[model samples]
Structures are given as C-alpha cells and as structure tokens.
Target: MMNMAQARPIAPNSPSQKQKLPAPRRGLHLSPHMVDVAVQVAVVAALAGIWEFGARFGALNPFLLPPLSVVLGRIWEDLIAGTVPVDLGLTLYRALLGFAIGAVIGIPAGILMARSNVVRWFLDPLVSIGFPMPKIAFLPIFILWFDIYDTSKIIMVAFSCFFPIVAATYAGCSSLDKWPIWSARSFGAGERELLWEVYLPMAMPQILTGLQVALPVGMITTIVTEMLMGGRGVGGAMIMAGRFADSVGVFAGIVQIIILGFVVVKSVEMIRRRILIWHPESRR
Candidate 1:
C-alpha cells in the first residue's frame, strides 16, 4: 500500500504545474516580410518628403524638380480631366499584346531548338546575330513596312522581347539533368509526354525569369515607339508637354509611367509566385 502523500495528485492550478507549461507568447511579433515591407515604405516616404521640402525651400529648381504636392495635384487634375485613362489603356494594350505574341512564338521555337539539331542549326546564327544588335534601330524598317500607328509599335515591342525568352528557354531545357530523361524513356514515355510532364515543369522557373526580363524590354520599346510616333500614350503626352514647355505636365506623365511600371512588375511577380508554388524559391 502506497503512502497517502505519494499517491495523491497535485492541484490543477499549483505553481509547480504552471511553471511546467510553456509561457504564452508576449509582445507584438512582426514577420520578416512585414518588416521588409515597412522598411521599403518608409524609404519611399522619406524620399517623397525630401522632394517636397527641397522644392519648397528653393534647394531644388521648381522648373526642373517640381514639389511632390504639385506633381500629385497635376496627376489628380489629369485623372479628373479623363486623359490619363485613355493614355494608360492604349499603352497597356500595346505592351501586353506585344508581349503575348512574343511569348507564344518564342517558347515553342526555343523548345524545338533544344530538341532538334536541325532547328538549332538554323536558329542559332540568327539569335546570336540579332541578340546583340540594337533592336530599336530596326524601328525605321518596321515603320516603312508597317504604319506609324499601333501596328509598328506592337511589332517593335515583340521583336525586342523575343531574344531573351528564346535564350532562357533553350538554356533551361538543354541544361536539364539527363537522369530524369533516361528514366522517363525507360518507362516508355512518349516524346510529347516527356516534354509536357518533365521538361516544361523543370524549365518553368527559367521560362518565368525570361518573361520577367522581356516584359520590361517590351514596355520600354512601347514607350519609345509612342514617343517617336507622337500618339495618345504617356510617352506621347510627355513629348507634347515638352514641345509646349509644360513642365508640370511632363512631370505628371513621368509619375504616371513610374506608377504603371511598378504595378506591372509587381503583378508579374505575383503571377510568377503563383505559377511556381511547387518550386523551392516559392517556398522561401
């Protein structure tokens, strides 16, 4: 028979029992991502403050670097006047359409080049020569062949975007581990099955990287074409402002461009994260 003290259970709320349990997490705990975002926002806010104060205090020339408030006011005015929507729409349409065309053609061509010696032999020289050349120089030829409207601009953007996608895709597919291919072949996988199931999934990261590079190039080409063509886009608005010596309007257009680029780049990054959810990088 055990002694009464030895057999008895402790009280539920005893101090010793409380000490054995884990302490509740205390204070506000910020995630690394939240901290990073806060830092970025703070830096941008600081820069904007400097811009506003510097212009107001005469440290910066108002003509050259307008006050942040003035620029925001100008943008608001344009937004209310309804010109911004039309310009933004046209620019986005041309850039996105051109990028789509480039990707559709470039991805297949790259896969073929990687798979077939004949295709590689034919395209390698063209890619090598064309990649180094300033694609913008071909604008004159494009202009002569097509009109100076959206057609030429879209084609020019597509032309600029093609090389990066092809190079990235080819490299990704060619450098894949041979062991997987061998195993797939051993299991009686057809060429189409191997490509779809193995090659594309493995190479998707590189393909997405290529697309990220190409989108900026496409946007730049679109803007330059719009500027040269003098049409209804942010670039065209900037050029018009320059001709009329409306510095405020020019600055407003620049702000629009910056916002547009930021939105687009962030959107693409989000898409890449979604598409690459199974990738190691996405886990990080």
Candidate 2:
C-alpha cells in the first residue's frame, strides 16, 4: 500500500460553493415565557414589599393607608362573606345588559353612517356633541326619566359606552382598503355579501378595540352611578364605608373595585387575544 495520506475532513457542504444548512433555525420556545413569569413575580414581590414597609413603619398612617393584610381581611369579611356578592352581581348584570344594548345600536348605527351619507349627516352632529360630554352629566336626566333605579343606572352605562364604540366602528368601515371593495363590486358581489364578508372581517380589529374601550367605560359608569346615587354595589359599599368613616371597610371596598377593574381588563384582553390572535400585539 502507498504511504497513507492524512485525510482532510470534508464539511457537510462545500466551503466555496456551499449550500447553507439554514444555521440551525431556532424554534419558538417557552424559555422566554418562564423568564417573563419570573420577572413578573419579582416585580409584584417588590411592590408588595414596599407597600408593607410603608404601612408598617408609619411612612403612611394605618388609618389612611392600612396594611394589605388588614384591607384583605376586611375584604374577606365583607365581600367573601356574602355582603358583596349580591351587589357585585347586580352591578355586573346591569353592566353586561347595558353594554349589550349599546352594541346593538352603536355598531349598526356606526355601519350605517360609514356606508351612507344620509346616515352620517343625521348622526354627525349628535355624535360630535355627545362624545365629548361625560355621560354622568346626564345622570340627572336619567334619574328624572327612569327614577333612581336599575333602569337609570343601566341606561347611564349603556350610553356612556356607546359613542366610543360607534366612532371606532365607523372609522374602521370608512378606512377599509378601497381596492377590496372595488374588486368585490367588479366580481359581482352583492352589497350584503360585501358588507358581511369584506367589511366586517376587516373592521373586526377596530370594532373590538372599540368594544374594549367601551367595556371599561361601562363598568366605570355603573360604579360611579352607584356611588353618586347610592345603590347595591361595591361603589355603594364604599360610600357607606365613607359615611361611617370605617377606614378598613373603605379600603377593602376600594381594593375590591381595583380588583374588579383588573379582572375586567384582563378578561377583555384575553377575549381580544383569542379573537384577534393574528394581531402582533396579541401574539406577543
């Protein structure tokens, strides 16, 4: 045998005339997710630590700024013990019903305006005038018309949440990619089909954004109505606590309101993600 030559290793692909192996493309992984969760936990712990320190060391007065434990205890006593369930239930019921009512009118009204000059002309003045004014300003009118009852409160929330949604929906419809409409028309699509298949789907993101905005407004209006007029809800409880100067109870009510608000926001966000999973923000 001839003297053995040291073998040179050949690369999986040629060095000069190489076909790339894609550099081992990274897959979607959950490691970043775990890190994010850890970071969130740390943040919460830090905030809680600061709050505890402030409350315990007299940086804040116990009466004015009670410890989280005390506030939570009060929440347990009043809310978890059954005092809040009925009131919260009623408030939510009204809020849901009111939002549903607003959606029925606001969405269709917005579409009509976007699609028809006649509808826009009729509605423009009202929307412009009403959108900026606080719905609470109409509280007196609601009271007078519906009598300081659930009807008044429901109406108040419904109207408060309506315009923003209607406006957003209108914007969505008006801002559609014009080419799609032209194409659909050229392709012999009926007006109804075009509206249903093209406009509605394209407008869904804006429409949902409006609904998200409206949802919080609806809840807030309900609480404010309850607070101002006195009714069965966390807001009423807060008012009652203030009337009695029960600091712990007041704090508890405020906490409950905050928690409720958070839950509402989170729920909206979850629904938004599910519906608009294609949205970049939702995907992240």
Per-candidate TM-scores read 0.93, 0.87
Clash pairs of candidate 2? none
Per residue, candidate 2 scores C-alpha lDDT tens digits across 198-217 of 99988989999999999889
Tell me the number of clashing residue pairs for each predicted model. 0, 0
Q: Give lDDT tens digits, candidate 1, residues 237-280.
A: 99999999888899898889989999999999999999999999
Model 1 lDDT, full chain set: 0.93
Per-model C-alpha lDDT, please? Answer: 0.93, 0.87
The alpha-carbon deviation from the true structure for residue 37 of candidate 1, after best TM-score superposition, in angstroms, is: 1.0
Name the top lDDT candidate. 1
**How does candidate 2 fare on TM-score?**
0.87
Residue 254 C-alpha lDDT in model 1: 85
